[model samples]
Target: MLIYPDERLAVFIDGANLYATARALEIEIDYKALRAHFAEQSRLVRTFYYTAILEDQEYSPLRPLIDWLDYNGFTLVTKPVKEFTDEHGRRKIKGNMDIEIAVDMLNIAENVDHIVLFSGDGDFRRLLEAVQRRGVRVTVVSSNSTQPSMIADELRRQADQFIDIVDLAPIIGRKGPRRQHHAHYDEREETTREFEDAED
Candidate 1:
């Protein structure tokens, strides 16, 4: 559950992870609404969203969304994408903002009572533990609804609470006339399906 109401809260969003979660849920997060949802529940000290931008290119499709979040209430922490060649000679791009996220969370530990982390990268399990050691209650928001599950098992267990992203839709769902796309939903039950099945 979202322990919102009276707790002092801060949201640390792994932008890419959040996008995938919402995409899997077949919804676009109304960033404005998401802010309001938390504000209504607690004192929202800061809203941090971390992402990597492809500034090397003249154009990137995700630019607009990033711009909106920056202009709005979010504190945007972004970096450039790194291009590399794998052993197989395949080109790949990787963008990591883990260090930034971990640093910001530690910095804010004393400022807030509850910390909401929106990621499922499994690697963050240690980060969660560290934050909790400071007496900050942590809540992880990701999805088991995604194929292999977006929320990592260790992270869920480490946090004071685990909030499945599916449960947040009503607070963050689209408003106005929605031109629905085929949600790209799974062929099998989201929860019953094994994590390996959705790793794609």
Candidate 2:
């Protein structure tokens, strides 16, 4: 977590990926605290959060959290999830936000001195490299404490700094019991599970 108070900082959060990583560590993130933690570190530019919604549902499980984030300081980037049947006749959903995140990061790179990525997906290795080439420092935050390790080796290597999410648990984790079923927390868990099932 090398940071300077004068540096301009931007945060990009892969909502589902982060939710899964936190869950694996048996910790519930205090979103407000997470934002404040970074805002205190440097000149906060903007925080972007990405997710996909099952649009066909009358009321999505993610709606509440989405609304809260939108109303808060986070810039929400979302799209409708596509439902389709696989070759094996299994119904699946597809809604990857990699392109959106990459494009946004690239577009904002010149303005920010540092970029904080809150995801462990290996697919973003090239994106981080590209941003670094533009002289913007990149910090990747994800857990390496899980059985299989939540952060990808390549992605971790690509980042200028790698911070394990577990280390920040004390600062950004919820203060109550570990497994309480708060509505927003349950929604995030369900949404992450849905994405995982689709990928599988």
The candidate that wins on lDDT is 2
lDDT of 2 by residue, 84-159 (tens): 8877897777778899999999999999999999999999999999999999999999999999998999999999
Candidate 1's C-alpha lDDT?
0.77
TM-score to true structure, per model: 0.85, 0.93
Q: Point out the worst 10-residue segment of candidate 2 by lDDT.
A: 178-187
Q: Residues 1-200, candidate 1: write the lDDT tens digits.
A: 65757788999999777766877788767778888888888988999999776687675555666777788899999888766676777565667778999999999998899998888878888988888899899988889887878787888888888888778888887776542231222322232122222222
- What does the lDDT read for residue 22 in candidate 1? 75
> In candidate 1, which residue pairs clash?
148-195
Off by over 4 Å in 2: 177-182, 187-191, 197-200
Candidate 1: deviation at residue 129, Å?
0.9
